[model samples]
Target: MISSEDHARLSQAIREAEDLTTGEIVVVVSEQASSYRSFPVLWALLAALVVPWPLIAITTLGPARIFLIQLLVALFLSIFLSFPSRRHALVPRFIKRARARETARREFLGRGLTRTRERTGVLIYVALAEHHAEIMADTGIADRVGPEVWRGIVDELTDRIREGRLTDGLVAAVRRTGAILAEHAPPRFDDVDELPNKVFVL
Candidate 1:
């Protein structure tokens, strides 16, 4: 969902940030982590089950009529929400964030962020649909930086995302993260760049 220019901004942020630290920083943006294809169907079924109750209590409808109405409503809702455009709303926020976290974890490993010689790799992962972000520091960095620090960065980035300025948010967070790394994981003279700076669209 990010433009090339925006992506470049993130890459630049990474490069600038990493220049002062041995830590490797990677940024990843994803529309969402999981398909959640079953949510629409489940919600439709739950809604249908609820529909018959109101009808039975308020409409004086016969059992057969209620059943028919319930079935039709369920079918219509399921069909309508099955479209990708509308499906995401059916999934809950907590589930989306959880999946995004899981996705980020996988990406951290997949991108070799966890493989940094000093274990100072840091991953910045964003899920557009979930409006969620995570900052994962590898062992060496995590041992130095507390979870509260990363939580603050994630919170700030999420606020920017809600305001539709994801680029700005990322840049700010990247700089902040870079500063943190510069303090705790300052670059070694012999350090070699181990990761790409460009943001990967997942």
Candidate 2:
């Protein structure tokens, strides 16, 4: 479980690692509830049924014909509402945004900022009325370092970046953290680990 203390630490780390104005960094870690993209899909399916049912029933001669028409309508609705291919001439901006968002989530997870393998995208609720800015990560980060340590790292990074000392601070923090981890838990020859040597930068 993540705590407020850890959130504060991570916020500081992020500040130190990136150059930003004061009050730019805000970290809030909390439990996440269900995400419902399916809701829109269901609504679309229902709307398709309602819109076509009357027309099909009135125009079709037999029950079988009506059923087929309904089926076709459902299929068309699903395809229409679903993400269209880039080949479509209508709206390219939406496609680009979706592609960028996917890439960002993948990158974030690859860096070890999030724990879940499920691609839920960057938004994670940390507490009541608070959220963390996960848009920076393309792939979610794993919880290799304990929450406390991770939070501390974020806090330090955030502070340094806000102070315009991002480059030096991040290098020092990564080295320091690596040394501490090495001293405490040196890897064995048989271990099959593939962790990155460098810390992720924003």
Candidate 3:
């Protein structure tokens, strides 16, 4: 978690270096944790559905026939059970509509902020936490600038928050960064102007 003193100092640096009035700075306090969870029960259930394949084979004409039947059964079962399991198991409890309303009230009272989900290719998230907040961008940024620069950018943003002028600091950082990028990056043209006499009669 970033101390208020640090936030103020960073904010001041950004304000002095860049000319900004309104924006936000994101400070990641720790490494991002993996979001995937292992569901033993779900895996076991799926395995159980395949266990009868041998019995089907011995009672049938050939292995291929038995395998095809088992495949169909598995597909059917997967489709049938996936939806309810997702609603009950996959989604976070606090994210359900009714629960979200209650959670939002508590969050507003405590932090004066709310959570929001952003979609870019896949769903990314931006949420206020106990001591800090997160800013999520698409994976493409890493591809474009590489991880080191990307991390540096995030760190710079976090540093700017220390100045006690988050809004102005961020705005200036964004504008100046954009200018630097524009200067160093290659030019892009949408359409070329055609010469009037260059048309050919075919």
The candidate scoring highest on lDDT is: 1
lDDT tens readout by residue for model 1, 39-138: 8899899999899877877888899999999999999999999987689887877888789989999999999988899999999999887777899999
Task: Return the TM-score for each candidate structure.
Answer: 0.86, 0.29, 0.27
- TM-score of predicted structure 3: 0.27
Cα distance off (Å), candidate 2, residue 108: 4.2
Q: Mind giving the per-residue lDDT tens digits that candidate 2 earns over 23-137?
A: 1112222222212234435655677668655766567457676666667777766556554331232224444345444544555455444542222112211211112212232
RMSD values for the candidates in order, in angstroms, are: 2.6, 14.1, 18.0
Question: 1 or 3, which is superior by lDDT?
Answer: 1
Please give, for residues 1-202, the per-residue lDDT of candidate 3 as tens digits: 3455555654454333222211122222221122212333454357656757666756755767666666766655555545543424543444443343343334333331122111111111112221122223233222344445434544555555555444443444444443333333322343221111110111
Off by over 4 Å in 2: 1-105, 108-145, 190-202
Misplaced by over 4 Å in model 1 are 48-71, 84-86
> What is the descending lDDT order?
1, 2, 3
Tell me how far the alpha carbon of residue 59 in candidate 1 is from the true structure, in angstroms, after superposition. Answer: 10
- Ranking 2 against 3 by lDDT, winner: 2
Using TM-score, give the best candidate's number.
1
TM-score of 1: 0.86
